[model samples]
Target: MLFKQRTEELNMKLNALAQSFIGFSFIAALTACSSSGFERTNLNQANQRYHAILLQQEPVTLNSSIPEGAVTGASFGLFTEIDGDSEDMISGMLAGALVGSVISAVTDGSNQATRYRFYNQKKGEFSVVSKQKFDKNVQCVEVHHTNKIKLYAVDSEFCRLTREDNSVKAIYGGKLQRIGTNAWHPATVIVKDELIIAVNPTSQEIPAGAQLIDGRGTWLIPGLVDGHVHLSQSGSAFTRPDMIGATHIHSYGDDQSWLIDQLPSLLEDYVSLGITTIADLGGPTKSLHVRNQLNCESHCPSIISAGELISATPVPALNGAQGPTFLNTETSAEAIAAVKMQRQFGAKISKFVFTSEAGLSPSQLDKLFSPAINEAKSLGQIIAVHAQDLDYAKAAIRAGADILVHGVMTAPVDDEFIELAKTLNVTYMPTLTAYEHYLDIFKRQLTFSEFERQFGDHYIIDSFAQLNENLSATDQMFQLFTRYVPFVDSSEKERSSLTPQEQSIVAQLETLFSERILQIQVANLFTVANAGVRLGFGTDAGNPATLHAYSVAEEINAWQHAGLDNLKILHALTEGNAIAYQIEKKQGSIAPGKSATFNLLTQDPLQNTNTLLAPALVIANGNIIDLQENK
Candidate 1:
């Protein structure tokens, strides 16, 4: 009898529970229909409340610190529009429940009420009100009497909102809240909509159709900067395929027609390799044309052109020969005249060649450098010199050259030269890779087999070989000079007369001479850079066996061989180069508001120096150029 009674009681309780659920469902449906009829008035009232809140709260200054509590209150005040224009009691009750639901969804504990001080406009004073924290996680607060709604949000946290139609919504901190899976929410909440319902704590499932991104495990870093390059010179006549070590290919005689014809394709190639910028040491006229072309295109690397070279009025003859057209002006006046000519052609910097071939007397040399310097100063441009020997370098410095284009090779640079360069603040573009390339070819008979494999074999054997052969007699003379140096002293005469075994020693001496020359060159470059002198990297491309954009990696490698830290190498490519070009303020760093120019490498270059050669994602002028498509 007792067991039967217990069973009957349980059945009765189940029936009552089912009946209660049915009644609640019917009431919810009726509420939805009633709310739909009043949607327009409710929305208008919400907008009015939002406008009132905005008028009450002044715009906050960005980047300024605000008290956390004050920020919370301000954010909540911004949500006043959620309460529709229903009966005051009904609106207040509904808005309170919504806020409560949100706080509950996001927070851990039960609901609690707290007192808040608000500015009462009508009374022109502060008033105390009781606000219950409906849900901690949702940040819901209930306004006791007023039919008003408000929501508060932190700057970076993610939040979910519910719409009037009982649909869920997701929103980022700034703008564009995501639409929830349920379409019941009004379409108005798609983007830029003010209606947001604080999600309930139990709602852990993502709203239908919400997109999520995993930002918790990743970080964003600034890109890499490539300081110097010549896009037009990469695959040109002087470049050979086998020269794997050549990084920069400086083109000497680039013209408008040639650049116009070649830059489009060349730029496409560079963009694919993540070269974001190039400092054109020569070929300004054509460079301008190329820059214009790139600007016309939707995306391309930046080109900083240095106009034409500002050599003496008559340029020096190569190897003291009269084979090609040379500019050799007699007086300093002629040099200044040449600078004026280049300036008129829109050159940004003056480039002059200080060489022994011009054979300018000391006084004339002084005059030549003076006028170029003065003109450059007047125009606010830098004067860079293609100085090869010590005499030319000293002369260029004495005349106030802003940059020394090549490392001194003919003679060792002394303390005095370094001091003068420091005093004058002259920058050095030590095309060390170029020197190394020449050294390898002359001493080791290294050929461009590797380079040819990438660039092509036909250019190497046909055009490149012909060019090298043209210089064969000059090379022979240099070889003969080395052979005769050993025979100068009688003490060395016996050594020269030695048989095959002694002859091997002579060959070793020749190798030593070549190595010593390169060491001397590196020493001078280091002296200048170490003595507080600025340095830039360039590949003297357009010469035989030089690589193009890829030469930058080799330059970094060479610097490491010379004992520079990886950071210093990076500085050379970034801040160092920016300073050399006088544009450090705008493009060198990843700081805010700076040009968004950077490289996306697979690894950190500072950690593993070889990472410099790794493929990267290149961004220039705020756009991601299609490297894969171009490749």
Candidate 2:
């Protein structure tokens, strides 16, 4: 009977609580339909009151020593006293609802929750407010509930809220709660605009509505640098609509009237292949003309042209021979005139031929070439000479040649020559591929079948016939006259009476002669590279069957085959080349505040040398050139 009477009395008090305010029962019914139910209204009111305290006329300074009554007043919106004790319950509920709603609104909208403590003067103890968001649009603003509103103070962002039945709800909101040293409990985090953040599987929490990018399961490394390549060649290759095997032929000298006519296509081809820069050895003045054309086009690679060849003398028999003749010059004045003529033609480096076996005296050769080297220095141009024999090589170096185009073949490089080259900082470009090609021809071996496959049947027939004719002429004429038999008038007449079968045998023997030249060239190259000479890469482009630019990789592979360290080979391709060309400041290296040029590899090249051949991204001047689509 006593329990039933107490229940009736509590019911009457609850009815009185609901009847005290207008629309109070309607608000309670709406709350019951929501997820938070009755707690929604109370939480909303609590948020409003919290904002009111935060937006007070004066800033509320919080510290460790605050009274609990003042905190309760601030949290429960009890700024003014009520008329009666029964009115206190009604006012407290309204204030708590208002504060809770305002707090929830602020925390939800901004996505940041903070823990704070305030002193309540009426309760004589500290009170804590913890903010937490339960959904995208809603936040739960919780207040520590106790017998007298406060007894213990909230130490951090974490707080325990107690209900009338003694059930506890641990509230952690506002700032993310740090659970331990360097460890934080996950909670809603707020991110502001214009802030940079790094995300990993750690204590740092991402705020609600924050943008994120997944970087998991991936590694970042430095980009690649392709030291030698032909960008104009690449550009041209890509521009063509029906480019199939045409690019291959274009890479060598095509039948086009002007090689410069192919510059646009070449540039596109280079960009497509991720060749951001190139060092063109020699072409017609047409190389310079093509360079000017590429200057106006987009996606062109950086090009460094050596202009045309500056030979020992203009010999119509040799390939790509042009410019003023350096032969027949006996005095320094004539040699200086030759240098001036080359400079006027805009040669970056003066190239000359020095061969003792070519029938020039040491004194005459010195007077003919040394002045040109001196004149080049006066004009601040580098000297690159093609010297075949040891005497010529030594003379070229002694004449201050900056680059030795061919390796020393007549004899092993002496220590004196090596030391002198190092002292003068002279570079060597050992055209090993050309030597290899010569070897292939002499031995009757096919070095590159891919080249033959790409050029159709008609081209193959023509090329083979041309090769046979050249071999026949060399065997019947030059070889016999130069080596086997002296070109006596009577002997020549007698040799002419030989049959076609005998001539064919002589043609076959001609193969052996070419092979010997190639063997000598390779031996010379091996000697030079092993002697620690400064070496750079060059494809000797426009030569028959030699792959342009792409030959750089092959050269490195050959060097590795000869037992050089991979890092040393890479350095040769990158830093060493830069030093060789004196362009180290503008190119090379993956560093900040430099030109944003780099080659992207599909895999780490450090692990495998073959990775250098992989096709991937090419970034130049801060833009990614699309090679896949162009190809």
CA lDDT scores, all candidates in order = 0.50, 0.47
The alpha-carbon lDDT assigned to residue 12 of candidate 2 equals 68
Worst 10 residues of 2 by lDDT: 48-57
Give TM-scores for every candidate, taking all chains together and pairing residue i with residue i.
0.55, 0.55
Q: What tens digits encode model 2's per-residue C-alpha lDDT throughout 1-631? A: 9998987677566555545642664787786766543543354343212110110011232332223333543544432223235477567756665666665554445433434333221221222443332232221223335321222223222211211111111111211213112222222111122111221232233332222211111111122333333222222211121211232323223433333454555555556555556665543443465465554244776666554455444433222222212233445676677567656656565556776534676556777778777888888776777776677777888888777765765456678878888888877766656456434433334344442344323332244344444444332333342332221212546657667765555555443344344456566556666777777655553344444434445565666655556555555555566666666664554333345455545443444665554436555655545665544
lDDT of 1 by residue, 276-358 (tens): 66666664343455365454343565666665555554422221111112234556676677667656656566667777656
The residue ranges of model 1 lying beyond 4 angstroms of the native Cα positions read 1-263, 283-299, 312-326, 361-364, 447-513, 613-615
Clashes of each: 36, 57
C-alpha lDDT of candidate 1 relative to the true structure? 0.50
Q: Give the TM-score (vs. native) of candidate 1.
A: 0.55
